[model samples]
Target: MVVATRELPASGYALEVDGRFKAEFATRDGARAGAEELKKRFPMLQVRIYDALTRAREDVQLPRA
Candidate 1:
């Protein structure tokens, strides 16, 4: 099976993975709060909150063979 992924924009506040919106906060502190909110809304898939401002930027793509 091939899974598709997307590289979210720098200013993107949320991500839609497989039709589901993965909420991402603007700051780490905010992300922490968003994490809790996301968990309450969606109890599936692991929610990862990142520091969009300080964290190193990287291109995210689907796994390739």
Candidate 2:
């Protein structure tokens, strides 16, 4: 499993798996722990996790602008 994370301006963190939906955390430590837990639970999923803020920024906007 591959876990990734990014820090938010509000002193929190965002986490995700396999480039899917994200989970917000109160702190980076919490995010790391969450990612590790996910890996342990889904060891065979080939997880690719990342933070929400950066990912959201990169994602396409809705409503076609």
Candidate 3:
């Protein structure tokens, strides 16, 4: 399933899969790091980051394209 993350101070990263919450983190950067790993494990899944406070979403860019 595709995974997404919402970074927030309280939840850190409200991780989701298939538009449903799956996990949580402690920091945005940490969540970004987690998303990196998620991309590696789920190569076909498109992972992204979202701002929980402002409701902003950001796509996760992999290294070396």
**All candidates: TM-score:** 0.40, 0.50, 0.64
Candidate 3: where is the Cα deviation over 4 Å?
1-11
The digit string of per-residue lDDT tens for model 1 on 26-47 reads: 4455545555554566656455
Candidate 2 or 1, higher lDDT? 2
Highest TM-score model number: 3
TM-score of 3: 0.64
Q: Cα lDDT for residue 18, model 2?
A: 50
lDDT digits (tens) for residues 12-61 of candidate 2: 45554555545666655676676667667766543333334454322221
The CA lDDT at 60 in model 1 is: 30
Q: Which lDDT tens digits does candidate 3 get at residues 1-65?
A: 22333434343455554454555666787778877888788867666665566666566657765
